[model samples]
Target: MPRGKARTAATARKPRAPNLPAPFVNGTILKDLRKKEWKLGDEVGKGGFGLIYLAAEDVDSPVAQTAEHVIKIEPHSNGPLFCELHFYQRVSKPEMINAWANSRKLKYLGVPKYITHGNHTRGNENFRFLVMPRFGTDLQKIFEGCGKQFSKETVLALGLRMVDALEYLHENGYVHADIKASNILLGFDNKQEQQDQVYLVDYGLVLKYSPDGSHKEYKEDPRKAHDGTIEFTSTDAHKGVAPSRRGDMEILAFCMLQWLCGKLPWEDKLLDKNYVADSKIRYMEDIPALMRACFSKGESHGEISKFLTLILKLGYEEKPDYNKYKTLFKDGLKKLGVKDEWKLHLPVAGTSAKKSVKRKSEEASECSTPKKKVRGTPKVATTSGSLQHTPKPAAKPRQGTPQTARGTPQRARGRGTPQTARGRGTPRTGTPRATASRASIKSPMKGDSVNSPQTIKSPAKVQTVKSPVKSPSKGNNSKPSTRRKVKRSRAKKVDAWVQTSPR
Candidate 1:
């Protein structure tokens, strides 16, 4: 990891968490690389499974060289360890999607190049493992750096590719159950490619599908226990339904749309919290129609809501025969009446999408390495002392209200929140939370066809009341005012509240 207080301070402000091994120190694994140790270098990252070390070296003398490669580790399991192993072996299959993107089959599936995989055993326990060429940082880090919003052209460009990738996997026979910002990697745009690329990373929960597109349990262990990152898991995934193309699409939509709306579908305050809470665990198709209805007003979302509805429909309904809706999806964007924006080709950029591009050849020599520079080693990040994780405080629980830990209310809205309609059930103190006025936002800036005037730069503003503050007294109080309000006459009200344990 890079050394400095800069990274330390940055991580503290970011609420970032890097998985640390419980039993083993990374130094032990560094020792195993011995001659290769000089080439590998120190630990770049560590996770629940194991450690990811940088290994930059020459073909002849691997250990004693500059940074060259990366090794990801899954430390030994303490007890039953079937799911993790099954998942790793399944997705890491030489002929699987990941492998196809590598040298074996020669498809640029936008995945990293695979290295080698192995594990170490201690006493009665066995540790499963794998390795890959580590490059620039993953998207989670990039998104944190970029913050909650992305420009339209940037989003459209990225959105089309990710969806296309998901569609491709579904067509082949696999489901990448875990799709989150962390699993997407971003760095140099290969010089030969159109621009910077966002390759899919971390196939931790990837599983295979039968020829009929149905799931076949892995012989290693298929108890329906294995799933994916909770933040990205689809309703079907949460319900123990086997991962499917639809589920994968749901995850893809979640990953892309989160950048736009900055809220989860099931967490919307527009509906009864009870329904969402219960429904959040069902399949996408099982989501209540009312939830879809809430999105009926495209005006409220500025066209973004319509795209999200499509994603929700894709997640819940049957996969649209791409053949049937390919042009229709394109037309929907056109119908939005967005002007000056180029049609981002669904499979690639419009140019690549329309042209008949040949698949990459299998010979590694035939294909030149992308000219884009690979990301350098990341500064090692461990939990810092200044930052603390906190959940929302429970709202003063109403006599009949259910409460989440911490005193914050769940889905409580009204005059001051999204859930409440003009103080109806809202507490006296729960005044509607004010939001950014459209007038205050910088008017649409002119740009290339890729970027449009209606661009979102941060997570859509969401308001959550941590605790109602007593209006400050003019004479008896000495505490400085803690509330802040910025009003704009033209924008719609957006409510968002974040919980943080004071530093």
Candidate 2:
């Protein structure tokens, strides 16, 4: 074999070691390329190939728990950190983010701003580290805490934010290949003004689709097949095609779907990448079927369905309409009676209470107004009179009953026909008359002169005697009356009430 071929054979024979970096001692200081020193505190977290430490500007005192920055360290041999560092250096500077937000007239953007990064030597081992603004718990943890599902409003709001971030990345000649819940984080400080903000992190898989102001050609490489999270990876990724703007949108769509529905159709078969890919392809062809599979019978989200449909139609090299995508989510939020206030509506990290309580309280306040109005009306008028009698013609002119019931009994009596009919007669003539008429067939009240007119007007009143028997509890007497005229009038009112009450 030639020398080059022998070198390649030897390189292939060597096994690659894992890229986990050794933990650094507390209070350690390191200088970046710019000569700015950062102090490392306790080890806050660890990922597959790196460790995260709370960091602050080099100071005489130790790093505090409230340090506003963090350092991510990985072995020098690791490729992920190297790739991420390059992406951040080239595209995620503070000036870049601020300019984009200002140009777009946005209050804020979700892209994580890169700080300083450099090489570090601990013991005999070399490491690469990057400094970034510290962020709170990621969306994955919140998603799990929320029973693996988010409300429709929250999902749309999050989707809109993600689109804004991805659009910025795309415009900067890069694509975030991995867009999952784990990579999206909320603001670190719990300040009320910033609580609504979220930052997208973990740029290890970031790819530059347009390095020279020209989109990359569509092609597949078998060596890079199935390169992302199986459950949410785009169809092109499964086929080993290079990542593109459309692929990012497709991944985001899957993420939003999972957030809204709690799970994906291919989630159960994630281990089988080929099956997951096939499932996604199958669903993409029929968006309604996909919606039906994820949602319960007779339930569907038009916004989600439309989003998926638009994404499925995108070509491998197509430039996604980011504004169109945002419109779908914004419209969805409106339909859900929500506005894009940037609030996440998720549970706070390390707490049993949910952040969604504020939203729920707002909804409760809105609904409470109508309840107060309902309660202001007389209980008998709303429950017994309006609810039971308003549907009938005979009861149409008795609107004064509910209004009069709110005033003194004297006002109800002074209202004349409607008021006196409801106030005095409701207790005795309304209920007891029906009860007595139904219980005993030989009762003289049936043959009494007071009931003679009701019986003569409609034979239907006789058949409905059993109906009013069910409504005996609705009657309430204010005062006794001995006037034969009042008794006679009460009997006639009772006939109307009994006819209208439900059986």
Candidate 3:
């Protein structure tokens, strides 16, 4: 063999070293690119591509376990940390987050603030490290500890905050391709004032959808298909398309669904990427069926259905209406009789509600509701018309019953005895009235009513309605009979509609 061929063969047989950073000793100090020194403490944890260390400013003493900051380190040759470092330097500066929050009139934003990053050398190897504020336990642990299910309130609240975070990233030209429970972290120190806030961390998979003020064209690469967590990844990701704003929202919707419903429909078939993607496509096309598959009959979540429907309609390069998405969550919380206090309530994890940090006078001014700018007359007219039309339909149903009752009796008496037989149909009119009352009572029990009020009322309502005639119950039998009539009528209508509609 020639000398060049022999050399290539020898090199091919050589063993490669793993791409990991060597652990540094406690009390080691390293200076950042800005020449600020940060002292490393004990090794606290490990990441997918690096080691996490408790860190603090270079000081006279040792770094404490309760250090206010952490440093993630990896070998210089590793690409993940370098990519994350650039993301932090470009989009996550402290001033940028503060400015965005102020401009948006928000009390708190969940994007983790970037501190500093620099290169370091130890022995003969070079390493890269980035510093950030320390965070408490990740959401995954709490999710598991809570039996893998979060309350509806918690799910909506988390979703609202995540939307804020993702909006901030998208505005700044980045997409968080990997959003999952493991990447969401509670605020630092786990203090009472900080529990309400959750930071979106781990930007290693972050991509810039828009560069130089132009959105990237939609294209798929077979090599990059199925690029994120299999079960929760967006269908776009499953198809190997580059992550975009819609992809981020789609991933977040899956996360919120899993948090509320405990699992997803395609979770069982996650090993088959194409199957999972196909299932998501089918469900997106028919959100009601998706809700039925996840929830029991008559227990569908309207808010989640609406959210999924809106995001699935987004085009590849289209900007999302962030405020509309927020309204969906806010309305859901309102139906649940709660306000979005920006505090997360994790009952299974035993997290108590706590007041957030006091706002500065400037922040208070920013938080005040802004005056609405008057738009065109047509828009204002449309808004008022919608508001006026909303209550009219509900009121008409109530008002028409009395008029029908009075008019029917006069007509029946004027006609004949056969007409009188139809007039004695007071029971028919009474049944609709009963249904209206029941609907009024049940309207407040939307969203997760199944896990709450329905659980409490189901047995009693079922028993009372089952044997109303045979039981010795007096006036109670009348109410149950009306309810039974309403159920039968509704079932008949549903059967008729289903049979008449196309398959």
Flag the better candidate by TM-score, 1 or 2: 2
Which is superior by TM-score, 1 or 3? 3
CA lDDT of each prediction against the hidden true structure: 0.43, 0.71, 0.71
Give the candidate order by descending lDDT: 3, 2, 1
Q: Count the backbone clashes (under 3 Å) in each candidate.
A: 38, 0, 0
Deviation in angstroms for 285 in model 2?
Answer: 1.0
Ranking 1 against 3 by lDDT, winner: 3
* Two-way TM-score contest, 2 vs 3, winner: 2
What's the TM-score of every candidate structure? Answer: 0.46, 0.65, 0.65
lDDT of 2 by residue, 388-496 (tens): 3222321222233343232223222222123223443432234333332222221222333333222223344433543342232233333343333343543665566
Can you write out model 1's per-residue Cα lDDT over 1-503, one digit (the tens) per residue?
Answer: 11111111111122124344444442344323223432344677765455666554343443422354566655454221234345434444445665445543322455544445555665665554455655555655545444444444445545555665566556556667887777766533332222355667666556665645555532211223224655566555444456767667666656655654445565554234224424444423433443344344432333334444555555332554543333433444555554423332222223322232323343443454432222211110111110112211111113223221111122221112222221333233222222112211222223312122122232333222322333232453435434333233112232221121112
- lDDT tens per residue, model 3, 1-503: 00011111111122234466778998899889998899999998888789999998956788987788999999888777888988888988889999999998888789888899998999898888999999888899888776677888899999999999999999889999999999999887643226688989999889999776888877765556677888888877766678999999999999998988888998997766667877887887788888888886576588888999998788878998899999999988889888664868866463321111233555676665352222112342232212122333333323444432332232222221122123334222223222322222222222332322111222245334323322122354355665566567545543453355343
Model 2, clash count? Answer: 0
Q: Determine which window of 10 residues in candidate 2 has minimal summed lDDT.
A: 1-10
Q: Pick the candidate with the highest TM-score.
A: 2
